[model samples]
Target: MSPQQKALVIPKKQGNFELSSRSIPSPGAGQLLVKIQSAALNPVDYKIRDAGLFVTHYPAVVGTDIAGIVEELGEGVVNFRKGDRVLAHGKFTNDFAGFQQYTLTDASFSAKIPSSESFDSAATVPLGLDTALVGLYGDQLGAGITPPWTESVGESKTPIVILGGSSSVGSYKLVKDYGATHFFDRNLSGKQLLAAISKVTDAPIELVYDAISLPETQSVAWELLANNGTLVLTLPASVKEDEGKGRKVIQTFASPHAPQNNELCQSSWAMVEKWLSEGTIRPNKYEVLPNGLEGVIGGLERMKLGQVSGTKLVAHPQETQ
Candidate 1:
């Protein structure tokens, strides 16, 4: 029998999550077997169980944010080795998901965790950061802006609106650190947001990122967009397109595994270690849950109830009993 590890699995579609034992999977070429130390919970984790949105198989494991140590390396994975501390963007596949004691990570999407960071903090970054990255720079799925890494990308004093609640960390810092000249309360209505934007700059609001992506928020974003502007949404777009205005609404799908995003994410992942070390990117504030994998159930429940706020909830998979 192969070595087994403790995992949190949903037995069937829209089923309850329970602790189970599963074989530790081996890494194939260009992959690394990670002994997961911390797995962060996202709203999508519960949404999957409640709505059966993504998984196609029974007894599925679903988690996307992970930080851990490399247990072994597969062929041609030269950047990592046994015992390296790393963080990765996990996928929907059972073997690659984060809700398990051990999982496999694609080498291109994994980055070494800095010495100054903890596993819990590192675990909060992958999904949120990648969503922002792909939305801002991905030509096919994003606003088609030039990435900051390239010399052609110049600093613009243009006013951009980001629709979401305030977060001192996470995506707030990501946008501000990247370059956001003004900030507005996400609670504002379309008219109020336009007034707020007017106070900041009149540079013609060319870009709006609706991080919330609710119907109400999407309406506000659509209202504020200029002709030929772009609106990036995290959820399915609720606002109708106005064809004559030449505006575009892109509902960003944040996954490194997607073929369209693979190369973009690879470039971003390569910069993650340096970004974390230099404080160019700040991980979300996180609270650690108890009882390891068992505590994830309650965490998901809290998320489903809209109880969690601002901070990310992380579980220690190694502490599973």
Candidate 2:
């Protein structure tokens, strides 16, 4: 390994970030040294870059969604070895390292790659897919509806509304494999939205996943809820308007530390891989920007301006090679 590699880093006291060379990391116990092949950009990537909210060190690595080959493994790391292709959502909570050419990740944080997908497409799945799985299919939210895992819910019909259907994460979740669950765009108008929803789910347009945070977009989901139906919102539920009908509102938060959530992420990734391989789910259209670490600022700027439409921006650290 080189003595140092460039990483996207931000200071604790300032909003500005830049790529800097630092010693390439070595895996600790139960950790893997990942030579990042690709790092997909997300909204939170810019948020942390601008706000500097999640930081543990003065000049900390940023961004979470990563896919790469394991260059080396630490003691007791049985699941991965040198040259194994893997993907991981870097931890944002404990100053989870990100955007670096190489970063140390726990074996639990990483997963083996699926053969059918490319490094770029697979990189975008971890964080968004993990969030969707935990929010929709986890025990707390999706208990009654059988997941794709068991054939019991064969051809199951449940209406799912993605409130912010246009965003990168929202787009990935809606199109992701979920047996026969119907999905609707909460942003669409009355008849058009209803028609779309009917095409996919057997549910009576009651259940929803509101990915949009805006009040105007969410109004339809609140009104459409069936009696005792559930609604999952990525934003806080407190701001949600009162639903006269008997309805349940869940605030969705995706984290790496939750045990049940850990399993949920794994399951969701596997499903995504299956769908990707079988052509059940179309890969999200992405604007591929093959840049080394120096391109972090430009990528975040495009993300902030909403310039990336229907396409997530991705960075390839391996481009430096």
Candidate 3:
């Protein structure tokens, strides 16, 4: 039998999560076998628990944010070695999923953790950052903006409003540190938010990144958006895109494995380490859950109930009881 590791798995559709022993998979070409240190929970996790969304296999293991240490390397992979601390964007597939003690990460989807960051902090970034990146830079799946990394995209006098500034994806420190000039309460109603934004800049509110994706938040963002503008959403857009104004609504494709996100992710993934090292990007605030893999179950429940706010929930896989 192959070496085994503990995993938090849903045994069937709408099933409860239980701890089970699963085989530790080997890395194929251009992959790394990672011993997971921390796995962060997202809203999608609870959605999957109730509806089995995107989970095709029975006894499914699912998680998208992982920070760990590289245990082994596959053929044709370079710039990484065994024992390197790394963080990766996991997939829905079992072997690449983050709910296990060990998981496989595509080399292109992984980056070495900087000395300044911890596994817990690094784990908070992958899914959220990728979601924002794809929302802003990916064609069709995103706003299709030209990347600042590719060239000098000059600063705009217009303010880009990002609703839900405290969400896991919205909690992105880059916005506060590098992008935003003003902060507003996320609880503001659409008219209030639009009015506050109008006071900040008269540039027409050309772009809005609605990381919350809730109906109320979407409505506010839509109201604030100007003609020929773009609205980026982490979830499906509930707002209708009326014809002729040239406004586009994009549902961000967060997965690194998606072909539409490939080019944008690759270019950005290469800069992750540098971004962290230089403090250009910062991880979200996170709370460590108890009981390792078992703790993640309750974390998902809190997320489902809207009990968790302004913080990312993370679990230690090695601490599984």
Candidate 4:
């Protein structure tokens, strides 16, 4: 029999998660077998449980944010060796998922963790950062803006507004690190936020990344956007488009494995190591949950209830009993 590992499994669609055992999987070409050290919970984790949104298979494992150590390398994977500390964006498949003691990661979507960062911190970056990136740069899925890394896009002077939630410190810090010039308290009304933006620059607000994407926030973002401007949303747009105006609303899909986003994400993933090492990008602040994999259940419950805020909740998969 193959080696087995503890895993959190959902037995059916919209099923409760339970502790179970599964055989460890081997990495195929262009992949690495990873012993998961940390896995971070996102709102999507609970959403999948409640809505059965993505998974089609029974007894599925679903998690996407992961940081761990390389246990073995597969064919054609020359960038990493055994025991390297790494972080990866996991998939919904049982073998590739993060809610397990061991999982497989595609080499293209994985990056080495720098000495300055921890598994917990590294686990927070993949999902959120990729979502933001795809929303900003993807032509089909995003605003199709030139990425900041390209030659003198002149977006530095362009005014951009982000409508984030109250627990947006980590997100705020990330945008600032990437060149956001202004910050507003979430309590501000749409009119107040527009007024604040007016004082900062005379430039029309061309881009609004509605990270919150609530109906109230989306209404505000739609109101603030200029003619021909783009509003990027993390959720469905609650506001209707004005046909006469050239404005567009994009609800970004962040999966790195999506065919439309594959090349863009690969290029971005290539820069992640450098970004972390030089402090050009930083990880989100996180809180560790108790009881390893078992702790994930309660964490998901808290997320479902909107009880978790500001910080990412992480679980130690290795501590599973």
Candidate 5:
């Protein structure tokens, strides 16, 4: 029999999560068997538990933000070796998900965690950054901006607004590092926001990333976006854009496993180690939950209740009893 590992699983669609023993899965080609050290919770996690979105199988394990150590490598793997510390975006498949003590990571989606980063901190990055990357630069599911890594692009002179700058999932501070200036409260009404934006520059809002994407927030983002502009929503777009404004709305799916994101994410993942080490990208602030795998239930509840704010909640799967 294969070795068993503690995992948090939902027994059926929209079922409750419970601690279960699942067999440790071996990695296939281009995959790494990783011993998960940290798993970060996201809004989608709670949604999956409540609505079963994106999950097809019963007794499913979920949670995508993962950080861990490579235990073994499968055939044709060369970028990583045994015992390398890494962070990866977990897939919906139970064997590849992050809710287990051990899971498989595709080599293309995993990155070596730099010495400066910790498992908890690194755990907050994978999903969040991927969403932002796909929203900004992914050709298929995004705004289709030229990736800085792929080509020499000039600084964006137009005012770009990213709603939910402080959300735990995606941190947009990197925009400031390049050329973003001016800050405003996202709570402002659409007209108020438009007025505030007018105070700084008259350039029509060409790009708006509604990372929050709540109905109200989407309304505000759509208000500020000019014709021929692009509005990127992390969630499904709730606002219609055919009001004679050539404004394009793109709902971003950041899964590296998704074919639309594979190439874009691969390009970004290749630079993850360098970006974290050089401070081009930094992890979000996170709070560690207690009681190992069991604690994830309560943490997801807190997230569902809209209680968690600003900080990401992470769990230590190995700490499960």
Candidate 6:
């Protein structure tokens, strides 16, 4: 029998998750077992917890962003070994889960940590980075994804407006990777906002990445986007009907199922690793919780309360075991 390990678990029936003792899984071939040192919670954690349907079974673990030290490498895992620091997306499932003392994952889904970054800072970046990359790069290139959108057009700089510059995904892209030519904060109003948007975009806004779900934001984006321009919204694409005069509306879904569409996920991770090494992307000021699997429940509850803003909520799961 496998040894029991501790984890923060959301019960199948629905309610807040609680810390519990569970089985510690060993790595299978092509997999590595990580001692989960830090994890960042996203809104989906609470959404799934509230819905209860996403969990395959009761007492299931939840957490999608993780950073840790590799404890063991299964057969065919040639790139990593014991004691190497790593980070990964923790899409917990009936098979592959992340919120535990030891979690198993395929080696391809994990990457070596840049020497300059702490696990907590790297922990908050992957999911948001992937969203930003998909918003900017997907559907344009069929192969060989490259950096700097300007490079593709050979000096014809295409301007993009990030709708909610303060959002985790938008802010990271704006302040770190894929620096858009223009950015629009949802908080700005009327003439002030329009002037700022106009100043950033020399030709009125043509491309917009709308992170805000507000109706007014949509109206403003439509008004500014030039005819035949493209818009990427984090919400559903049905929100606006495209007139087809070169205008494209994209619905962004950062899912694990479509690995083909994950080039953005791939490119974003590369940029993050580079920025981490270069000191260009600093860690979101963090409210580091006490180290332990048991500490996650309280931390997640605090996350649900929205106490931490522009700061990541993290826990060291390995210490509790």
Pairs that clash in candidate 2: 164-212, 182-200, 182-201
Candidate lDDT (C-alpha), each? 0.88, 0.68, 0.89, 0.88, 0.90, 0.68
lDDT minimum window of 10 residues, candidate 2: 178-187
Name the TM-score of candidate 3. Answer: 0.97
Residue 284 CA error for candidate 5 (Å)?
0.3
Q: Report how far off residue 186 is in candidate 6 (Å).
A: 3.3
Candidate 3 — number of clashing residue pairs? 0
- Candidate with top lDDT is 5
Provide the TM-score for each candidate, comma-separated. Answer: 0.96, 0.82, 0.97, 0.95, 0.97, 0.83
Candidate 2 runs further than 4 Å off = 93-96, 140-145, 176-203, 241-244, 266-276, 279-282
For all the candidates, what are their Cα RMSDs to the real structure?
1.7, 3.7, 1.3, 1.8, 1.3, 3.6
Can you rank all candidates by lDDT, best first? 5, 3, 1, 4, 2, 6
Q: Residue by residue across 48-113, what tens digits does model 2's lDDT show?
A: 666665565677777777788888889998867799888787876322465878877767767776
Candidate 3 overall lDDT versus native: 0.89
Off by over 4 Å in 4: 150-155, 165-178
- Judging by lDDT, tell me the better candidate of 3 and 6: 3
* Clash count per candidate: 0, 3, 0, 0, 0, 1
lDDT of 3 by residue, 1-321 (tens): 999999999999989999999999999999999999999999998888898788899899999999999999999999799999999999989999999999999999899999999999999999998988788778868877787898898875656778877787777733656666788887788888888877867778788999889888899899888998989998888998977888888888789899878888988999999988998788888999999999999999898898988899999999998
Give the TM-score (vs. native) of candidate 1.
Answer: 0.96
Per-residue CA lDDT of model 5 for 1-321, tens digit only, reads 999999999999999999999899999999999999999999999899888899998899999999999999999999998999999999999999999899999999999999999999999999998998888888889888888888888877867788887785447443456345777886799999999999999989999988889999999999899999999998887888785878889998989899988888889999999999998888888999999999999999998898987789999999998
Off-target runs (Cα >4 Å) in candidate 5 are: 173-179
